[model samples]
Target: MTSIAHSAAVSAALRDGKPVVALESTIITHGMPWPQNVETARKVEAAVRAGGAEPATIAVLDGVIHAGLEDSQLEAMGKATGFLKLSRADLGYAVATRKNGSTTVAATMIAADRAGIRVFATGGIGGVHRGVEKTYDISADLQELARTPVCVVCAGAKAILDLPKTLETLETLGVPVVGYGSDEFPAFWSRRSGLAAPMRLDDPADIAALIRARAELRLDGGVLVGNPIPLADEIAANEINPAIEAAVDEADAMGISGKALTPFLLSRMLDLTQGRSLIANIALVENNARLAAKIAAAL
Candidate 1:
């Protein structure tokens, strides 16, 4: 197997046995616009550090798999155009071609596992799209969760996805989904997705214990920690549901398919919501990062 190189700061943190939380880079490259994207990335990293863990934001740049990035790199990536949104299928391709790419949930899990980081924080996980019956579209994240041992913390699957189907798919894959502090699974921009979670965990210590137990049992898959957005920051299901439906409908009408669908829908939602969606996204990501840092510290 090829050895993965960690950044100098990440290597030092790993060597010193400090808590380290893995983060994905797509949110910096493809998820948002410039300035705010870089700003939010820094704030999320700060949140992790405040909760006593080192943040390692993973990405592939110029054929090198970076476990963490410097401020300049983060800024440049946020402003750069034409970066690929990488998953398991194309992560190697991006590296092989020496292209700059942002890590998706699946790619991040793979990188985090290799780096021996047990926890990752992200805004949301991709899942079954609403029209998957015809498009057969599903995110690689579900399969990655089934195989990788790195616990992932997210608000939930993106609100635009088919929540019940996503949950069912995760169940079928034998991946544990734990709703943090609530019985209801959270939607990305909203506090609740109207579906009951398979399990609920109210404490960070208990979450850490669950992860340790899973490792002890030699489980192959990771755990899903569904942390809801703060009520103050949430957009409410009713208000956002219509916007999401309109975005999906527009994508279908335009014949947008495959990997392009997500970014397209998200971009539409950002405009339709007058940028409120982006605000909620940043808040939930920060919330997940803080919780993930605590769990990483405990582990």
Candidate 2:
């Protein structure tokens, strides 16, 4: 049987009690074009290292689960085609089949927990789709957060999702949504989601303290740290909402649903927004990576 983690650096760091931040790999395989995807991956990893932690970019390659990827491995994955977009339901199947796979938020949480990592960073999380009431298409990311013992730092749930429903579901699951250094929840490309966060933590140490408290209380779930995108890079909610709505409507009209829906919406939004959305995405992810590194160090 293949073990949980195959990265020697990650294994050694875990054994040595060093700070390590878990990273998802779908950003490389499904989030962007080749060279840019590889470049962004390297930048995010560098940001984590600059903030005083090791970056474990999780992926599954030919049946082995890698907790950290080398630059060559990242380049290969970025250029490769037909990699599985793995979530909780299919992660095991991909491993068993000896296939190449990119880890989504849920899959990354599962791998991070198994590797004993306490913090993860990503661009944004998947959530309830806009018409989820009819489609019943909630992302497995929410359920993973309800049980995984890791702190996830992100801009927020993707703006393409139903932010209100996602927040409500997180509350129902007892997952704490902490807005880092901000009062309003972030809306992926926008700095504000126009919704209040369930909680707020101003410092990395305080967030780490909260995680420790959760452990003390024997809580089995993770926390969501909503770090807003940099003000300079954000496309204010008012400016971005129309584009998002149009993309959602287009997806619905074309019968785009399930895992295919998010990518489709994002692609349309990128075009509608003149590629600004992708730039904002890169900035926010790097910011989250830095904060996650700090939290992991404090832990």
Pairs in steric clash, model 2: none
lDDT by residue (1-299, candidate 1, tens digit) is 64677878889889999999999999998888888999999999999999999999999888788898899999899989989899999988988899989999999999999988889999999999998899899999999999999999999999999999999999999999999999999999999888999999999999999999999999999999999999999999999999999999999999998889888998999999999999999999999999999999889
* Model 2 misplaced regions, further than 4 Å: none
Residue 23, model 2: lDDT of 98
Q: lDDT tens digits, residues 24-62, model 2?
A: 999998888768789999999999999989999999999
Q: Count the backbone clashes (under 3 Å) in each candidate.
A: 0, 0
Question: Could you tell me every candidate's TM-score relative to the true structure?
Answer: 0.99, 0.98
Question: Runs in model 1 with CA error above 4 Å?
Answer: none
